[model samples]
Target chain A: MAATSFQRILVALDGSDCSFRALDFACHIAKQYPGCTLVLVHVIDQRALETARMVHLQPMVEEIVRTLHAAGESLLAEAEAVPKRHQVSATTHLEQGIIAQRLLACAKEQGCDLIVIGSHGRTGLQRVLLGSVAHAVAQLAPEMVLIVREGAAASAGA
Target chain B: MLERILVPIDGSPPAAKATTLAIEVATRFKAEVRLVFVVDDSIHVLAEPSYVQPDYTFFADKMREEGEQVLAAAAKRFKDAGVKVTTQLRNGYVPAEIGASVKEFKTTLILMGTHGRTGWDRLVLGSVAQGVLATTDVPILLVRP
Candidate 1:
């Protein structure tokens, strides 16, 4: 059986509250494994870049990339606190690609044993227009995946 | 109300591990397991010679026979564990057929092994569990082997 006891863990983050909720779950898992490696991955969706490219706007593209870089860095910084608080070690990576594909590719390339991802809690109209990234990654990743729905983890404590 | 579960088996170790985990969870829930196998008609046709034109009926019969043996072995595992066991054989897309059967048999849940066998194999064909998840609303418990 593929190890439920994770040695290498990957958490996909988007700087959303839901993503932070997933990070919390990842931290809990890392605490359990103790020796496990945690990787925080942020994928800058290619669609955002394509929008900038369509308008032939270099300035927009630069601004978007810069904003995304800072967001990725801050997300990782926030995630770093989780592992440190738990006395665990983790590394972070920020990449540009299609969100789901990049997440799956990084997991495979990095030899990650498991993935923890947060569902965007999208429903109704938002779901129909923008498909869930978590859903797509779970479909695409070959490794074990733990899906934490928005508020599900917090509500569980309640 | 199916507190017990049924997982179809094909003798592949990936499927076997899935069956094992299903049995564990079903046992935990105090449920029984029913094993099912579906013979994909395409597999038999692809194996046939176009020049000689092997009889399709006879080929399907052979596939059913093979499926029975696979399910029988799977049934034995659960039966040995003192879990009520049943066997079924069907024909269609594996995931859709499994979903239909889950409803038909009133299965409470479906459990599947995600990776087929090895990492290399999964990186190639994607995953059956992934396909099932996309197709079905039924809650799935995926096991990785």
Candidate 2:
């Protein structure tokens, strides 16, 4: 039996509350494993941009995509700071594609042993329309996947 | 703050891998490990002919015995590793039982394996790991072998 040593971990961050919680959890694990490296990723959904382009002017769509990429870079920079706060350094990646596919590709390309993600815990129509990217990544990723939820029991009570 | 780690194991290779992973995590966190085997009788019901059937109790008893064996083998590994371990054999829907076990044990984390099923099989059978994730608030660490 292979032991769980998570030497390289990939964390998907989208600047959402839940994703930040996952980042915190990843940092904790990295702290626990002295040699562990955390890779923070932000994927810009190209499909969304394409849909925007179909409805809006080309220049407007290009501008929106550019702004989104800039936001992704800043998001990665902010997430990289998280691990540093815990005294653990992290690498960042900004990619454009389907969110789940990009995250899984990054994990495989980086040889990540584990992929950590935050669950939005969406239910009903929102879940069906948006779908759960974390769930998709969990289903497809070859590495171990950790799904983190924020607030714990306290939020459940609310 | 992970006081207990809950692991749901079937007699599959992936589950065995998950057990090993759970042990590694438990050792690192200094947490007790709780291994649960859920004997899902609903599958038997679905497979059986509606007209004629054998004693459900008898079949359930046999499944419980088999679950015990699987649990024993898994528990032995943890014991040999000198990790604090506990085991449970639950007879119910696999996902629901696991969710209840998490609450009853106050499990800080759930560690289990994902059966890498794709296409029709995954859609029709669904996944226990996904079900548990949907139903429970507990954090899950899924190992894919």
Candidate 3:
């Protein structure tokens, strides 16, 4: 059997600490396989903007959406820097939609063989209310899914 | 750096797919593949009284034998592919055994298959993969058949 090679790796970045950690891990993996490209993705969740519009004035909602778009762009910029620093080739994607659905669709569209994500590790009431995007992607994605925890790299070192 | 990859098989079709993926990963990383077959005797012990009863030891022994067969077949595939492979048989709950094996073997990654259970069935039975995710700190690579 030929060894599984992840030619194109799709990593979800949301500017969270854990998400950066996942990017670091993905970069390391990309370095291992020669010519592997890391695709950095950040989704501007439209549902969140919709919720803001429902609870706020039109002008306020527009301002919030602008802020969100700016944040997403900066997050993608930061993610791109990680791979650049490591000398790994990468591309950035800014998307809009449900976070998990967009992520799955992007991975398929990009022809990514692997999807790397960070788990928030939420529990109890908060988890039920917020739900886990990583969990949903892991359960549904056609490609292999790698769910990186907060301290996964450190734990692996020890 | 992944040094040891743990994969649990139960003689299911999904398990076969997981094994294939695990071997591919191990071969790429030059990591050892540890194949574990968990003989979950708890299911038998917890069965309804209406269920047929056999000697506990007899049932366990038979399960162990079957598990060994499953492990051997999986091990051969890895060995044939030139990946260093080891096999073990554990007697206990599936998720618990998988977690224990991860710690005992110092596994760097766990590559396992999921049956993709959803809706009411998922809530009622719960998923072993989800249980492992909650209990273990090791990184998991979940593959669907």
Task: List DockQ for all candidates.
Answer: 0.09, 0.48, 0.52
Model 3's CAPRI class?
medium
DockQ agreement of candidate 2 with the native complex: 0.48
- Candidate 2 local lDDT, A7-114, one digit each (tens): 899998988877887788788778778778998999998888888878866778878888998998998998898899998878999999988899999999999998
Query: Whole-model Cα lDDT per candidate?
Result: 0.69, 0.80, 0.80
The DockQ-based CAPRI class assigned to model 2 is acceptable
Model 3 misplacement above 4 A: A121-131, B46-57, B116-126
TM-score result, candidate 2: 0.88
Q: Tell me the interface RMSD of every candidate, in Å.
A: 7.3, 4.1, 3.9
TM-score of chain B of 1: 0.79
TM-score of chain A of 3: 0.88
A7, model 1: CA deviation in Å?
0.9
lDDT of 2 by residue, B33-84 (tens): 9999998867577446673465455677787898899999999999988899
lDDT of 1 by residue, A78-138 (tens): 8778878878788898989988889899999989877887656322233331237766766
lDDT of 3 by residue, B36-83 (tens): 888886757644355655445666778789899999999999999999
Q: Count of backbone clashes for each model?
A: 1, 0, 0
lDDT of model 3 at position A11: 96
Candidate 3 all-Cα RMSD: 3.3
lDDT by residue for model 1 (B1-145), tens: 2264658566678788777766554554567777878776666555577735665667778878988998988888777777787889998777677767775776655666665532465452334555555454443444555
